[model samples]
Target: MVSAGVYLVVRIFPIVQASVVTMTVVAAVGAFTALITALVGLVMNDIKKVLAYSTMSQLGYMFLALGVAGYTAGVFHLINHAFFKACLFLGSGSVIMGCHHQQDMRRMGGLAKLMPITFVTFLIASLSLMGIPPFSGFWSKDEILGSAYAWGSEHGGAYWLLFLAGELVAFLTAAYMTRLLILTFAGKYRGNDAPTEDFVEDQAKLQSEQENWEIKKYDRSLGGLKTLYREDEEPEKHEEHRHVPRESPWVVGASLIVLALFGGFFGFVGAVPLGITWWQGFITFGHAHHAEVNWLVMGISTAMALGGVFVAYIIWGAKFAVFMRLYRTRLVQVLQAVLANRYYMDHFYNGIIVRGFMVLAKASRIFDTWVVDLIVNAFGAGTKMFAYAYAWFDLWVVDGLVNLAGYMWLGIKRGIRPLQSGYLQHYMLVLIIAAVLFWVVRYFF
Candidate 1:
């Protein structure tokens, strides 16, 4: 659910193992997604949206990892990403609650003190996400990049593009994560609560003293920030206190704490710190190429990660006003505008592809409704008309001929009816007359 694309990548990994062409296609698509999502993530202001694009970007890494035949490395990265990203989401939830459900990072400046536990844990997870050292994400991501380099070195010049793309995505990952941390946890408080008390008073105070009023303590350490549960009071009596965001409940904090710890330290299990074979021994796949660490690839990838973070710090942290002024320039404004709109992907889809498909679909529906239904109705109407004609023919033509023959038979029977009467005198007279006539005729002859 977190990174659904990785499962698709895993399903296609076998194809890469089977055919070279499929591997190339998968790798190319993966590289494209990696770059695209990173660029999309850069201009986002919402915390969850940034993390969502980050998820997509991490999925790109997994796909590219599979592309280079790094099945174990890709799976490892998938597992590690799950732990760290879960921490990130939960921490973001904690921040949202503390800020009264504000999701825009622009409205959130300094929250490191307001939600200390969440901040610390989130920072740990962020570091892991950026592939910082001693973190689970670093171990897995390093292996994936190493696989790309290994593939490129063995294959040819074109295959090297996968490595370059992967490394570029890594840098982008660091940049976005660093930007998120700086904008969220390192600036001044932006809330309107008690705006008059510390209104432009002390700009030199440390992070914790200036931003927070509550005692610096984890809520879970004190039974998850308990309060008296009075049953007799009406709901409206304490309505104001109900929305105040306290530390997360122990159940939620416990999960975050556990995941954060794992995110920070789980890499040791498969760490490749001195060309060690610790991780590869456990993998059952017969990939002998990644048996040891490649220092060049690892070093280059780590340096790029650091460089991305530094770049983010320069833009968002050290010289925030200067960069703000820079962004106001026409060229930077245009770039931000394009990046903010996700390169007009929505416009292309909505104005072109979606509209085109809708037209075709409407045409198909009309054909089905009018044309096909009309033909079916015509067949039904024709069948009914033929039935009516057959009924009339049966009554007029067939029955009429039979009835006429019957009437002729009845006429003949009626004419012969007088001969059937018992008449003895008439018959004897007729016989005598007939005999006399016969003798007279004989004498004359």
Candidate 2:
């Protein structure tokens, strides 16, 4: 589904290529989307939410590549993204189910020791997603970055900004994904087996645990204009439940392993820098723009990705306390709030667009009842009156006329009956009377 739009643009390349304005707009939108979504992923607490935003960011990269006329690069990233992103999603699901529907990463830790297969496969896929070298994502994403830079060099303008934005998005992607791995699998267990009293104490301090608390009360009223109040319900009873997190089933593990393998090595078939053009040759046909791999761009992108990983490790892994102290500052909190709320897009959609449509629906209902229904009812009453008048005419005037005709016919038959009574004298008399009347009329007139 995510690939459909990119595929459409690729299929209609002639039209897209013909318009510079279109290409510029596509590139700008893609770059913006990639940057924004990467920012959003940095603050997510749910494992799946992080992955979801990551998928959107990757799509932005694909569009960015296409926008820069890097058709092969766009398609290459699409295919590689599918492999790694699918593995990541499946691994997240496996973790969720293994933890008995626990998607909150704060409640998960030290899963690597328990779910070995899942850990290995997830790490491999994450490496590819981070665009680490020798992995599939690195080859494709590097190609896109190279293509963007090359396009910008040939076509001077703000188009060069796209390359910088793509590089920034890559750094953020690596940072957040590293943060995810560290939080979910590197730290000590924070889940059901925790000391009961400490767990209860932590749960009671809702302010400190804003992520869990916010989900329960999603009534984010916008300046007292609208309040989305959810129904009240009883809270779940907490008990000292102890269960060890285990690896996913064999089927899930097997699938992850296969995807991890492809995600790990699939890029070898399309290494443009290495002159392995099997993938680009097949996909680009005659329109392929072959260029020597820009080693400078590759080095810079790799440095950015590795720098991101290092930064995430220092912040989330090594100095979590310091990170939290900074996280609690006013500036960071405000930024966090905005990102957590998805930039208030939901509020705008629900409060404006949805409510406007609802008001239009109500107005339509009123018009239908008062105007449409009234007109229809008036026409119905008029038809009923006309039908009654027609029935009266049919019963009295029409029936009466028919009865008068029948009576006249009966009288005429009676008057003519004597002439046909088998009497020759009567017959001759009638003939003579008719003949006398005819002669008198003829002579006088």
Candidate 3:
């Protein structure tokens, strides 16, 4: 998320500010991120994701600007980028909605004429991203690069790499922006619409168009158009045709047109070469250091940017045979694999980091289960053993003593059985005999 980068930008700098080490770290991270996201943007099929990565790449540039002490330049681009980028994204959304929610570039083509307002506005935003001549993006980008060049020239070590990366990202920005424009709006209609000569028969009737995106010509790679592929292909399952795309409604188109105006001319707020300086004035930098656009850096950066646009046009719009072969090579295949996987961030996060944590969690669960059960089972086993011992004592020692007493009493009763006769005479004779015996004993003593 942009918030994460913003966190880094806001928090980390104040710890060690206006120093070479800070600048080096910030510049390195920003350049690396810019390059990575730019590559990812090149291979993105979904219209919105390409723009999203572009947004991230632009932020990286802002960081780079800050690192080089061109604080005003960064803010300048940020303001210009925010306006144009919004218009681009919203316009893309309109096209996607117009195309029955088809977001892939491969699924879209030849809508420029149909959606004139959206296309023109979107193209303006693309030019801003491309950093083409006389646009606000050009001025802002020129300032950043000029700042980077100034830093490198001022310090001739590996600091030059910052300038190099800045230039490289500039070109890449142009390439991806051009590619998006050409692929989305230049070619023949490739979407779910049936192959028909008339793209739009009646404008008013198209408001009631179908809202489905039918699948067709996906894996075959018609005329070398790159596809978002699913391995399965079921022609019978798909709807035969989709609705034709028309211009966006007035509400969507109006904002895009207005935003396009801002993105187109907002750079005039800060003159590129010290003519007018709104953004440069606002920079919180050393008061003594003033940045003026270096003519040399400006020429080179502008050329590289425009060259990127030319190269993109040659590859996608011109459809040169050489570019197609290059794309089919093993190197490009490997590169696509990398970009498509988003430089393997997801794999590292989901596969390695997440899996590692899950393993730890499962091990802890196993340990907790066994250890707690052992402690609990120890008490249960001890209790059961004591119960068994008590049962044994009750059955043998205590019960035996009681039974033995009972038997002795029973034996004495049996020995005195004849004395307990029912006859009264017998009972009286025994009493008299016992009395005489006792009298005699007492006299003799």
Candidate 4:
């Protein structure tokens, strides 16, 4: 997934090819990333972290190749990287599991004898990644460096600097890879007390076996329940034990063996030095072109790789006491500190970029709470007030008018109600009164 960015940039090569500036930027970034990550890998203590940095460094190399318009070279390295890096990762896992989940190289050594298959497989993969000859990494990486140099020669100035950086990265990659292999599988074992889990598991198994044997040998009539012996006659204390590293199961070893074989010889598919062009033909994009192996570049790269291995062997393998003395120096300590801290890039991100984003997030929350919520609350209050006014008008003015009309009708009904009594005399009286009222009104006018 981390390499996806390089793949994406390569996928859009037409657009990238259109801009010289983009290509230069990609090359510059790749060279810088490759060198910096390799330096970081040099100081890493965890076996897996070393491999992680190695993957990044190798991805940087691929990007450098793509940036220089070496599409075939880039894709070739990508494929070769997959085989070797996967093997290295699997080999690391096998080591970790064999060491009872221990990953620190400082706590591991002399595992080659215990896990012979893993060591051989891991070494082959390491050699391939270091770009040693005959391995797939050597062919793929040599092509990338040659491409960088050729591109730079055509365009001088900072382009040359990029090529130089690529060379230096190759050197550092070998150094760190050799350092990892040595610390992990060379010298005397240093993790005698580190495998606590394995030790505990073995002790438990031993105790269980002892208890089961005792249960079968003794009769239950001699005691009660599962306890055939009295509490005072309990089992003796087990002796202390150290965990031993062992070879991984056949399933895992088989995968590593297969990948190691490819890592060792897969480069023959694109072995430019040997005039092999099958890989280039198969994975070409746009115009397929042949890559000629430059003897000078090949010689210098091989020397750098070997030189790196030699330096690492002296420092970590041959002269441990002398290296320890140098390691304790103030300058060396400071250099180690910088590399180990990844040149403080993590701190800058956390202190500045991350902090700035967090502050922005807090401000957004405040605005949402104060401004947005206030507007919504005010609108709600206004709507509620308008609803109350409408309720009051309906209850008082509108309903009162209707009630007044009803009362008036009721009063008139009451006034005329006595004339409608249920009697024949009452009806006759009402008719006589009506006639008298009519005569009186006519006489008085």
lDDT of 3: 0.80
lDDT of 1 at 315: 87
Candidate 3 residues lying further than 4 Å off, grouped into runs, are 1-4, 7-16, 193-242, 286-289, 376-445
Report the lDDT of model 3 for residue 221: 25
Ranking by lDDT: 4, 2, 3, 1
Q: Local error of candidate 4 at 83, Å? A: 1.0
Compared with the true structure, what per-residue lDDT tens digits does model 2 show for residues 1-445?
Answer: 9778888888887788789889888888989999999999998888999999999999899889988988888989998999999999999999986776666787788999988899999999999999999899999999999989998998978889999999999999999999999988897767665445634554445334464445446644232211222222111212144555789989999999999999878988898777888887778835765756899999999999999999899888898787779868999889987997789897899799999999999999999999999999999999999999999999889998999999999999999886797888888998999999999999999
What TM-score would each prediction reach against the true structure? 0.79, 0.78, 0.74, 0.78
* Model 3: colliding residue pairs: none
What residue pairs clash in candidate 1, if any at all? none
Please, what is the whole-model Cα lDDT of each candidate in the order they appear? Answer: 0.78, 0.85, 0.80, 0.86
Give the Cα-based TM-score of candidate 1 against the true structure: 0.79
Per-residue alpha-carbon lDDT of model 1 for 320-407, expressed as tens digits?
A: 7877788689998888879877899988998899999999999999998899989999999999999999989988888888888899
* Model 4 Cα lDDT, one tens digit per residue, 1-445: 8778878987898898788888888888888889899999999888999999999999889889988988888988998999999999999999988876667787689999989999999999999999999899999989998999899899988798878888898899999999998999998777764445644554465457666666668732333322533554322211124566789999999999999999888989999778899998898877776778798988888999999999899888896787778978999999998988789997899899999999999999999999999999999999999999999999898998999999999999999998777999989888899999999999997
Give the TM-score ranking, best first. Answer: 1, 2, 4, 3
Per-residue lDDT tens digits for candidate 3, residues 1-445, read 5636644664555553557898888877888888889989988877899999998898899888878867677778888998899899899999987776667677688989878899999998888887887888989899889888888989888999999998999999999888998888987778764533432332112322221111233533232211222323222123255456788889998899999999888888887474777666665455633757688998999899999899888888898899989987999899888997798998899799999999999998888889988889999999999999999999899999999999999999999998989999999999999999999999998
